[model samples]
Target: MSYDTEHVRNPGGAPERITGIPTFTELLANVDLASLYTDIYLSTATTGPELAETADVSKKTAYEYLRKLERAGLVSETGDSDGTRSYEATAFEMTFTVSDVEVSITPELVVVIAHADEFPVIERVLEERGLVTFALAYDLVVAHSEGNVTVRQLATLTDLSSGTAYDIVEAIYEIADLGDDDAGPTTYSPNDVADEPTDLLEELTDE
Candidate 1:
């Protein structure tokens, strides 16, 4: 979908046709909480029952969470009836600091993004490999995108064990589209990673 909501940036005024529910498309007041809900809704439109089933909450709790998401401007009600309502996630980039913590939310780093349609190939890869796996690989590739980064650095960035990070090189080699024979299940130093991540990028997109 085409960024259903306008991205809010540092201390902006409210948006046009802003919701009356206090948070109206400005930088999020509660960045972490907003990220949690936005992540849940970004890739799909869901109704109360559907959300309840997936989130394993009571129907009333689902509706309560839905209300909060609506207020946060991350979700807008698309349909409603005497007994039902559907809410769709809206795309919005966010950068905010709460206390000493800073966050940047975008389509690339997060498994769920409201602009999933814009990156259909990425979406397809996510569909194929699933979000948890793809996000790890994505983090790995992005870390190395700048230049070679150590397995320890990747482990820290991707929240994998050092050994797990080391093991992933085999999978990366199998999936890499490049002709680098050195990538194929060969011994690599804990401090070594490819200088380029173009192979992963190419696998993720036609562009």
Candidate 2:
């Protein structure tokens, strides 16, 4: 007797949604919090139970991922529904403060920017200066971009040690030609200083 094999219309009971949400599309290329954020965001729904079920993750995992989105101010709680909380996807506006001014950013805007497409071209700067110095460099650059920031404030922003902070300020001075030769305190903008050559310090040493 010959046996007939049956072909099922759907295998494994339908395709399963992918796990892990990404915070940013670029992050998909790497394993990072951004990617994790994106994954959970795509999987979850406004309904708590539905979200938990869709992500195929425990409630705790769902909550944690949701919290990350909340902290970034990308997600907001819509309101309570049937005694259960509900959330809806909101457009992510890339907004941040520089100096005392607020700036709103958009994905399309980032795409057109010369250096905005990728994150952290300053990794090498950090490697050379250590985490503290790298952070100082980053904050100071941001301040410069925003058009105003004090050294002390930048220090706090970057969490740099006093000595490290001073060094960063000096480095900016040299880069922008606002050295002691200038009458006023050296002030620079992030946009102006952010594009320093990767080998700037090295090149300076060879001179």
Candidate 3:
């Protein structure tokens, strides 16, 4: 996966824009497909059989998801010489702005969504709270990890109960391994955005 730093920081900074992305509804509804997409996104390039094995799905299912992803412009064929079709996921950062709030859908969030089955809290949040809330939770978790926000502040801003906010932060902490100093490098972070939710909320509330 490749991303230009300037393009990530400011969506308009890119020379070319990506089209034909799947709708958020389509993305959130297909967890298994999202998992396969994440697997491809994390790798340099991979074949259908390799993805099938990694995601524990049948070859047919893997290929089906890959076709869907290809149609959505998320993955592209790498033209392997061995006659096996390999693919690479497109690196992208899509920001949706509604009123004063912005929600970004990046590879990191995709990983979080893909691992929903492995993380009960993430699944619970997705099933109950919905994708927007989950994205906000992820941002808040990042803010908290960086000491920019507190659990009470998260609850206040998001109207979630303090306990719920704490749980969300903890769950994201484990999922993203924010506490692990040895955790590998990541493409996305709180600093990647021009205005984090905490800052936006602070300005809105005059905090």
Candidate 4:
């Protein structure tokens, strides 16, 4: 998971230069904090206990973090069960662009941009598929876009159960606003990438 910088020489006897480069300090801080935020973004935790266990933080700390995220407009109360309040991510995305430099970036950083449940696609996905299901749904979306449309084929390609593949397809359809009206069985378009995510780290990317 380490990114090694690759230097590309400018052609035509021009000086080699990079643009919009982020400083080491900015890079470190953005990356460090981005990891923590990404954890929350991609977490499947719907309750304090669940979040604490998943994030490896204390329950109290988990609640505290959730409060912070809530204030930051990243999470909100969804429901309650057995006296425990259930919470879910509110759908937000964060990105830091590093330009004019020898940058080595990973797709992990640009996972998803969900803030305040603003995006309809994101809201629908979180509402229908939940946080954990996003990764599965995203993989299926990509695979389907690449021409694998059958349940059996998608399951075989993703190593998921047939039933699970079906569910992921359903979610992708829901997210993309596709429905029973389509002539064909189902197809995912890359235009819907805004809400489709294959990784749980949350959607983010650099320019």
What are the C-alpha RMSDs, in order, of all predicted structures?
11.6, 18.6, 8.5, 15.3
- Scanning candidate 1 in windows of ten residues, the lowest lDDT window is 24-33
Candidate 3 lDDT trough over 10 residues, lowest sum? 184-193
Q: What's the lDDT for all of these models?
A: 0.50, 0.46, 0.73, 0.46
**Candidate 4, residues 85-114: lDDT per residue as tens digits?**
776554532333344222323223223322
- lDDT (Cα, tens digit) per residue for candidate 3, span 115-207: 777777778777887768888878877877776666666666777776677777776777678956664222234355344455656563363
Better structure of 1 and 3 per TM-score: 3
Give Cα distance to truth, residue 83, candidate 3, Å: 1.9
Off by over 4 Å in 1: 1-42, 81-83, 97-103, 107-161, 164-187, 190-207
Q: For model 1, name the residue pairs that clash.
A: none
Local accuracy of candidate 2 as per-residue lDDT tens digits, 115-145: 2123333333344544334534544544543
Compute the lDDT for candidate 4: 0.46
Report the poorest 10 consecutive residues by lDDT, candidate 4. 19-28
Tens digits of per-residue lDDT, candidate 1, 10-124, equal 4444445745335432222333333345545564666766676665456676567667767767678787766788777766655555454444555334333333433444444
Q: How good is model 3 by TM-score? A: 0.72
Better of 1 and 2 by lDDT: 1
